[model samples]
Target: MCSVTLRPALPADLDALSALEQRCFDSDRLSRRSFKKWIKRQHDGLIVAETPERELAGYALVLLQPGTRLARLYSIAVDPSRRGQKLGEQLMDAAEDYAHEERRLYLRLEVRKDNAGAIALYEKRGYRLFGLTPDYYEDHEDALRYQKRLHYQPADAARLHLPWVQQSTPFTCGPACLLMALAALKKQTPNTTEELLLWREATTIFMTAGHGGCHPMGLAIAAKQRGLSAAVWSNQKGALFVDSVRDPDKKAVICALHEHFVKTCRQESIAVHYQDFTATDLDRAISNGKIVLVLISTWRLDGRKAPHWVAISGSDEECFYIHDPDPGEDQAPLDCQHVPITREKFEQMRKYGQAKLRTAVVLGA
Candidate 1:
């Protein structure tokens, strides 16, 4: 592996950066004029990596947009010789870190729809496909628009979306909302060993079937309830559902709480993730030996507080505990309770929540 030093780009580095871009890209080549345009864009930055001999191995260019806290990947290129050495990943990491450090809410980029390799890399890094822009490039090629969330905390996610969370806007809904959510969980709360099985089954069914109710939360909640620490690596940010009273971004923030818990834990706990969600990133975080939490809240109806929060615990013929956050603060255990939902119910609920957004959780390896 080549050990490259990451540093800010200088005027002298422009030639190298431009050359790298020219070598890596075709059809939509950026000329000298365009390079100047890039340099003049404020809220934008450029970074480059060098060998001990001061050779440019790779470069990344980013531009910031107004009104939205999003940074665009204007360009990135790696030397042909360094292509398979993961230099692209390094450049992406450097660019994304800089964007986040500057308090950008999300990283947005457009990749050629046919660029499978680049798509795989970005998707593996937790970038979610939002839409496609037709005839976006100079050659009229359609571009895949992706968004990667930077907020790592639920509070941060919520604060970003609903500033009121930090502005003290006051949750006027009061305990009623909390009670209803709690009551939903209480219906399946298990007390006895047999009841535990029943509760777990029911909750699992509800969660795997919904948006955020992925099973990773269940395992962590179970571990926390047992006084054991739990950790889960998360990929997606922002909630699958939207609330008229709250910001949709609140969902991503709330879901990230599980990642926060998993990080603070001391045990080699579970890592949760979904099929389409970022798996390699979560796998790297777990290294191995972590539970998988499937986010199932995607089925929530529009404008509903997506019943999107759930953790999947262990499974057996008897039951599986799905960690659910809709239970509200009132019924939320000192740790958390394991609720049971049936497999049939779980699939049914998934069909319901499939319309919303969702992602999985795992421990960072």
Candidate 2:
């Protein structure tokens, strides 16, 4: 409420920071060791808010993500006495300023899904909820991931021409991605009903209890059936998602589906490249006026085991642009659908399953 000074957190404030964190958070509170480590790191440092009496009122921890131009608000807390005085907002502003100075393009954070007050505060400060992580906290509560773009500039890459974005259903990512590729290559747009129909055509027949997602081979088969040239690039030769299911019947069904997809692809003489494809491959294909649908685990986005399918729309030396169908609720259109991430980050996100399989489907007219 009064004049509070904001400055870089120092090593001497470790114990005080920990004490304040405990008062501010009931769970997931930072430890004294963490405070000490954060205070010393240049890329991952903490900023503190001091009251008029020179006491620690609040602090914000900002961590620069490795191999990506992003900074994360790892944690933030305020003294109980400093509630309702907008100390959290001031701390966030300071954190964003620091991240921008670090040359970061985006600032993101995860808040408890039920924390409406904090969510409101973050939304008011221009942070948009991009995705949700199921059972992210120690208490098994979900976390809402939010992002704020620090700078907006037209990309330097010659972006690939891609079509409309739509995440038709929960299990339709693979189909949705493939549809975009087909539409872009065919110079046609598929409606929502047709998108869901493609999902039914390409679904794996079994999932981790809920509706199943589309398999890369099934997607290739669907593309071929639609009169498009297609090929599968993946390391998985058999039974994908079998180990992910515990029920014997579901596991059996998954194996059967995997075998069936393989049989169909082989019978149709579909080109199956059994190796990992790099960003170079993607760029070459797109530059040659082809479309590709790639598999990516959504670990970097929301810390969940979401095996997703996204179209490789365009690429430059720095980043890969994707046409994502399911960008989730509460996110801006640009943040949700059209995403630009570094090639290194895309490589990290493209692998799924226990063996971390790399997979994609290259499509052409």
Candidate 3:
């Protein structure tokens, strides 16, 4: 565990990252031109390890594969002189952070068969070797295709004190949408020390799964109610054209509601970003510490329900805060005048959206 700051790599960092790449790998050193291209791509993410002195120690690059539900770790390299200090792990952690931020389900990378050290490091971190590519590397060497799945448990996530989410709403939306709306509310008013903590915790949890959405809107609304300014970002679903009408106009209504909220924010002069329904967009927002709310919805109950919505209100060592909404009446009420709901059944409504839509919202500063 080296005390290193894992941050986005810029063009100014090319010389350093390139140097580390040359020293760490034999056949695939990225050229300056390649690095430039990498920096320009929106879906490509690069993070670098830096010492307190601002010296580069390692670097990792990941690219999102649209609709594949996975991210590819194009490269990761640490200075040979600084090996064994968990620099690689740190780099990998940064990569995981990037993946999680973008709502990627897994990270896939190819490693040379001869690089036992690399394989060991990856395996130690729970990466699974799923396939082998013959002659994948230079000199006709074999490459091991590895992937790591990222998961988060609610119990392990951060805790949020949004009592309003548990309150009941007369609105026709399902409980899930209600919870999501509430979660979004608290995320907005993350000014109080407690609210900020809850916000951070909530965002961190969503990052683990690489998601973002309207939960951010709710957070922003909550913040606005409290006189705070915030913005959120979530990723777009690749090629999955979403028509709110086909789904009983639920999505359309939500978007319309979101637009109305945005208009309100504009009147109040608050910042917001609804990152094009793609996880990559959401990842960028969360990595920047912006409150990103992600909703995960499934069609198991048949797509007759509103998508589940949860606020990534706060984050911690092992988990993030998931402030579910409350559509039921008579829930845990709080002193926050900004939030409109109670806290009791907030968690219950989160299940309604579980059927069709997963949304992400990022609140800006």
How does residue 70 of candidate 2 score in lDDT? Answer: 65
**What is the alpha-carbon lDDT for the whole of candidate 2?**
0.79
What's the true lDDT of residue 232 in model 3?
44
TM per candidate comes to: 0.41, 0.61, 0.42
Task: Report the Cα lDDT for candidate 1.
Answer: 0.50
Candidate 1 global Cα RMSD: 19.2
What local lDDT score does residue 301 receive in model 3, on the 0 to 100 scale? 18
Instruction: For candidate 2, write residues 189-244 as lDDT tens digits.
Output: 77788788888878877777678988888899989998889898887676777767
**Candidate 3: where are CA atoms >4 Å away?**
42-44, 152-365
Per-residue lDDT tens digits of candidate 1, residues 1-365?
A: 66899887766677887888778777787677666655555324678889888999998877654222446777788889788888889889999998887766567788998889999999999987855768878888898877676764222121110000000111211112112222233332322343233234222222222323223454444444443334443333332223321443554554455445444333434444433443343333223433434444323212343344344433323233343433332221211223333344454443223344444433211
Q: Runs in model 1 with CA error above 4 Å?
A: 37-44, 153-365
Q: Please, what are the lDDT tens digits per residue for candidate 3 over residues 14-93?
A: 78876777887777678877777776663347888889989998888887643223467888878888787988887888
Window of ten residues with lowest summed lDDT in model 2 = 329-338
Alpha-carbon deviation at 218 in model 1, angstroms: 52
Model 1: per-residue Cα lDDT at residue 264: 39
Candidate 2's displacement at residue 141, Å, is 40
